[model samples]
Target: MGEPEAARAEAALTTYEDDKLKFKVQYPSDWTTSTGETPASEEILGGGARDLFTISPPGANARDVNVTIVATPAGADFTKMGSLGDAYGFGYGLVVPLNKPRAKKGQEDRIQFAELIDSVGKGDYYKVEYKFAKPSTGINSIFFVLAGLGYDGRVSHLYTATAQYPRAEEDKWRAQVEAIIDSVVYPPTIYG
Candidate 1:
């Protein structure tokens, strides 16, 4: 997506801001948000403690699609983190592996598609996507990970948006989730 696409449409959106995190994003109005804690037992990514905001559609369950935006003091070696395989290891080592095998009905999950791109604007950012199967429920799960390397004195921040839904219902949530991902904004003061 380009800068134009980065701008939010005039559709109804709910704003989430944190002066301390020095960033904000607008998600669909229908989605509900839950605040996150720092130094959590379970983390969004490795490095420093992460403050997570999980936005979910109404009536969502464990299998529903949701977006998790996080701010952490973690930093990544951008040079080593710009490929599908690299993203996989980064997630596996620092976060959750996409293809973790689950003994569900004797079926093992696998990655269906994966891509990585390094977008250089004010700084370096790696954008990644992994679509895989969830053997437990026989559904497909999609993960979009955006890592913004350090800018000036600020620590690295990551945005991870994910969806797990039946194939029949993907059309209903994909675009909405993408928009939420693109709407993320970092304060200009942090830039070099």
Candidate 2:
């Protein structure tokens, strides 16, 4: 009665490539794409992202139903961070300052859950999942993040892909979000 499952899935996605960021990914065909310079507040490792690319579902704001990718030039400090697990810890610790100021008095934002999903390429790339609860809005957001290292001849770079959506819709969107994350092809990297 309908298209085959494989065909239907393929037809629902569109591919995006960033030459400067040197990465490729597939997002839902109905979603929109935006590119810009990443803000200092979004920097996780302190190296600061050189560029940012975001894919968002229709009618969704920047903070809702979006996947963002940032490329940061890997410095000596980043190299010394060791495994992907260690990097996640170091980066998440920085979230306090970023969140504290925006926290409301009665409804403080907090991490509901966090876990290290897996790593590939002998720790060169990793996958993690976390949930952020916003009691102010009475909504919980689930985040799926992919992190990896890439080199472009002269310098090394850290590229992170983060996908988030309302936890209430997890049953409806988790697979699609995971598909988008898994579709990423990192820039000139041995791992990914």
lDDT of each: 0.55, 0.70
TM-score of 2: 0.72
Candidate 1 residue lDDT tens string, 97-126 = 333544455444342222222222223344
Candidate 1: regions farther than 4 A off: 1-11, 38-48, 75-97, 100-124, 137-139, 150-167, 187-191
Cand. 1 TM to true fold: 0.61
TM-score of each: 0.61, 0.72
Candidate 2 segments exceeding 4 Å error: 1-3, 39-49, 76-123, 137-139, 189-192
Give the winner by TM-score: 2
